[model samples]
Target: MRRRNRSTDRWRLADDAGSAAIEFIFAGLILLVPVVYLVVALGQIQGQALGVEAGARHIARTVAAASGTADADARADAVLDTVVEEYGLDRSRVELSIACAETAASCPAAGATLTVTVRTAVSLPLVPPVLGLDRLAVVPVEASAVQKVSRFWRDG
Candidate 1:
């Protein structure tokens, strides 16, 4: 009987079989961390924008309430402060510009336009409170609102 070539026919696990694929899965998460971070960061930016726009709309209403002429710039600034203070946003991050146009029926000018801007540095979410390495997203966001200054009065 021929002797079995046990040494030549032995089966052994190779280190390379599907090892690369397993490694890829782990590495993929490392690469994906940044992308996930960016997605979350964007949500914070959107929140900031919405907050500013809401603040602007409220300011317009305030202007309409005053019987006297409203200092558009001052009003805009004040509104920003009120809204951002609670959210830890800096007033300086916001920009306020107003235009006054003569109206047909004693309107508070044509309208008051307010723009609020927040750079990533200022508006980064407090939840993370640190920089992320995954997706390097550092961008500013802006929100704007224009309100028609109608006859000023609040009878209720």
Candidate 2:
């Protein structure tokens, strides 16, 4: 009877020996998944923000340097497209707005202040497209840049 009791005690201890490892794994997973998702979501938002900022800054410069309205529009479009592609931004989601401080009936007029704004909404990773949840889960990012048109600009 004593031997049997000892055997039961050993069995109970053995049963608990590997439980720490199991608990560790379970706890690690519970904490790791959310953290990893947060990192990925933040990365997406940051990348989009950088892309928008670059687009705005480059487009402002391009427009400010242009010779005329047509040239400015063309250059701005080109810069925006390049930045969108380079930054993996959704072209359909991007919005660009340009404003000038001078009201001489000419945007980006010589010595005028050019302000360019870029906007977009970033969607979280792994969001299911069901019930419009994917659309609802978005973070809006916007960036703006200002540049002064060259005073010696020519109207071509």
Candidate 3:
């Protein structure tokens, strides 16, 4: 068999010139875009989770340490507001619930265990507002904290 000429083969290869670069860019975008978006979404979720957890814990502590039910309510509201602002959470979306371990008529009673729960949804970054996509593409985050009120606690 006769050997083929290298020059002819080189010309044939020219048809695919720059194909590797194009393929690389296409594949990289296809893979890297999702990865980058996942990272951003996870970061947002984690931040919101931490914020919720902090809010619950702090509110529980504040309520447990308050002098009376009215004081506890005020302190909890203040802490929740601060936490929402600091964490960039939507105040309108945030939900808070407070309960006590004991079946006492009044929550946060003296020597009772106070439980506080904070819940919210984290909207994914770059989500479009159209078609309610922003609302649908959200991760729910919830946190709860429990603290014991002082046995000597008294309401004024």
Candidate 4:
């Protein structure tokens, strides 16, 4: 009887030893998956932010280099279209606003400041529309740039 009880206790201890390892594996998986997902999401958003910043600078420079108001507007639109295509962003979701610190009807005036703003929203992956987190899941990114028209620029 004493030998049988000792053997039973040893088997029980062996079984319990493996339970901790199994639990540890499950806990690690549960923590790791969400962290990986968050990292991927953040990387994508950072890329979009960089694209927007570059686009704003390009648009401002393009407008400042134009010869006239009409030319500036056309060039700005073209640059914006290129940015949308290059960044793979939705046209309707992206908002562009331009403001001229000086005369609005002129392109290259001396000391004129051309400001360009780009705004877009990035939607997080695997975000469900429940728990009132839908709005929180969408991140808004904005970039602005200002360029001055050269003093040597001549209006046509």
Instruction: Pick the lDDT winner.
Output: 3
Error of 3 at 82 (Å): 1.2
Flag regions of model 3 displaced more than 4 Å: 1-4
Estimate the lDDT of model 2.
0.91
Candidate 1: the clashing residue pairs are 34-134, 34-135
lDDT of 3: 0.93
- List where candidate 4 sits over 4 angstroms from the true fold: 1-13, 102-108, 129-136, 152-156
Clashing pairs in 4: none
lDDT of 3 by residue, 6-28 (tens): 99999999999999999999999
Scored against the true structure, residue 19 in model 1 reaches a CA lDDT of 82
Q: Candidates' TM-scores?
A: 0.56, 0.88, 0.89, 0.78
In terms of lDDT, which candidate is stronger, 1 or 4?
4
All candidates' lDDT scores? 0.56, 0.91, 0.93, 0.83
Candidate 1 stretches greater than 4 Å from native: 1-25, 70-78, 103-138, 152-156
Question: lDDT tens digits, residues 39-140, model 1?
Answer: 887877667767666766676666654444546445656766788885555566665544444433433543433223323233444344346632343345
Can you write out model 4's per-residue Cα lDDT over 1-156, one digit (the tens) per residue? 335688888888887787788999999999999999989999879878987898899988988777666777799899989988988776787888888788756544656887889999988878888996766888899999999976655666
- Taking the candidates one at a time, how many backbone clashes does each contain? 2, 0, 0, 0
Q: Tens digit of lDDT per residue, candidate 2, span 1-156?
A: 334678888888998898899999999999999999999999999999999999999999988888888888899999998999999999999999999877867677889899999999999999999999999999999999999998877766
